[model samples]
Target: MRLLLLISRLDCLDELDALICNAFRRRGWEVIFGEINAIAADDYRCFTRGLLLPGSGEPCHPGPAALGNRETYFLDECQLVWVMSPPQDYAARDIWQMLWLASKRTAFVNSIEGMMFLDTKHALGYVLPKENRVFAYTSNDFSFLWERYRQASDQWWVAKPANAGCGQNVFLLPPNGPNVRTTLQCLTGNAVVQSLLYNGEVGAFKPEYTILQKFILEVANGEKRVVVVCGEAVAWYGREGNPDDHRSNIAQGGTPKSVELHSGEVKLAESIGLKLMEHGINFVGIDMAYPYIVELNIGYPNGLYNEMLTSGVDRSDRVAELIIASFENHCSLLR
Candidate 1:
């Protein structure tokens, strides 16, 4: 299968991309990098009767902005578009670009509409199921804002941006804590009040947890993440808080631990994957806590390969598998 992995020009040397490249090459697929800035054309026809436009960076296609604009960059191949950029910057900005692609009938991964919905924490909380068997969610209203955190039922709760990733804006809002107000003031929507699944039970989340349902938290420390490829899981480890803290997000100063998925986690992962697939949320990573899901990662996300490295799991193979599967399932339909 021929594939194009869209990414930033500077991220060309990314370790994650290297891993994916190695895996795709071993499969004998014609995998190429479509770094929007590297190519010289705004649009170039591919061997498969497909057109490749590298956005508005270095590649200069003769097409108009409507045909192709960097901010509004669009692809018509209708194949799988793997969104690997961070949720805040690329995820939000590219929302319309993706929407444009879908408006043209492109069979994008996760579908543009699904992704846009998942981009906001407020929207995620409003729509995610409270009890989907494989998934569970909870949330705290920002109505009282920080003061509501004083009524916390759990020892610790997380503060997160609805559309950001890599521990950029996550913080702990302990019951009656001092920073809860500061954190809430930094956010625009409601603050999520989730039960802390700390001390290795991070996989067990309360059924009422909704706002915290953006990504799956495994084990505990609760920041390491994983992805499922065709019912298979690739895991990543994150440290709990700091040596002095409790938030395990590596980007937040928590060290990465190796958390391999056991049978239960795998079972949970598959169940969530099937449900998401049914909803057309392909190319997704549902955050799992043992047998329940915390959130659905449908839009662009982060730390995928870094987490795999710390866990000793070779997920690049599964990435390749999904890439080929995307070529067959979505991209093929594009043609």
Candidate 2:
């Protein structure tokens, strides 16, 4: 029988995660769901340390010491371990490291390192052709970025954190905008001040780098998200920005809508999916504004549920089938 271990933050679990778990369980696969915080590593051994939810039944600690126990398995025992989220901080990083080490014995849907690489906006350079890539620059120095922004020919630009999502801290820089300087300072945390103590020492914190990209006017129309699974585009949808905002992220109040996929967009997504597959990243979300690819999401790339809701076509089952097919192929190669 096939076995799968799904790892995600319990507190962050949503309808999507539940759908995925049900998809696997319906196919007669043994599924174990747990939080990353419950995972522990002792030397080379990695296993969950708390109660885990089974495919169908009450939650129970999966060991001999548990009250209700069926079977026990280490990280290596599962046929596939799907890490649904990327490491966000120190604690998460530790858990991810353990999973990475255990990956030698069991497969992970998207390799931890691959997701981390795609999580950074810098990956756009490697994934998309220059003609279709957004014009952008990243720097931690306020003065350096300011100089480049001033020299740019475009009347409008965007500044955002290099590795943030959900449109947090994203800003539009209008030509000669009065608050440009303050915005840059705030984004980079470059404001300097003297110590309150009598010590009279002046200190300025090291700036956090931000991504500066030419604002594409087409984004005002909307941004499209393409979900690619197993090196193929499976679902597509659009997010329209609200009147007061330029970002089309649903988390930022943008609304999801059904849209026809342009032939060029489909081709672009297929080509990019092949490259991502080579890195062991099986699931991805490609964000686009017409011809230019704005960004990519490799860590729990969403939009499948929305697509199902809007188009009334449930691709989740197809996604599960493709993933299982890929897993079987990998196993055959090893054998």
Leading candidate by lDDT: 2
Cα distance off (Å), candidate 1, residue 52: 9.8
| Candidate 1 Cα deviation (angstroms), residue 253 | 2.4
RMSD of each: 10.9, 4.4
Sliding window of 10 residues with minimal summed lDDT for model 1:
59-68
lDDT of each: 0.49, 0.76
The superposed Cα distance between candidate 1 and the true structure at residue 76, in angstroms, equals: 4.2
Error of 2 at 111 (Å): 0.7
lDDT digits (tens) for residues 51-147 of candidate 2? 3444565322212222224333577767888876655476777877777888888888888778767777888998889988878888877877888
Model 1, span 42-108: residue lDDT tens: 4432211123333222322111211222232234443444444333344445544534444354444
lDDT of 1: 0.49
Q: After superposition, how far is residue 128 of candidate 1 from its true place, in Å?
A: 6.0
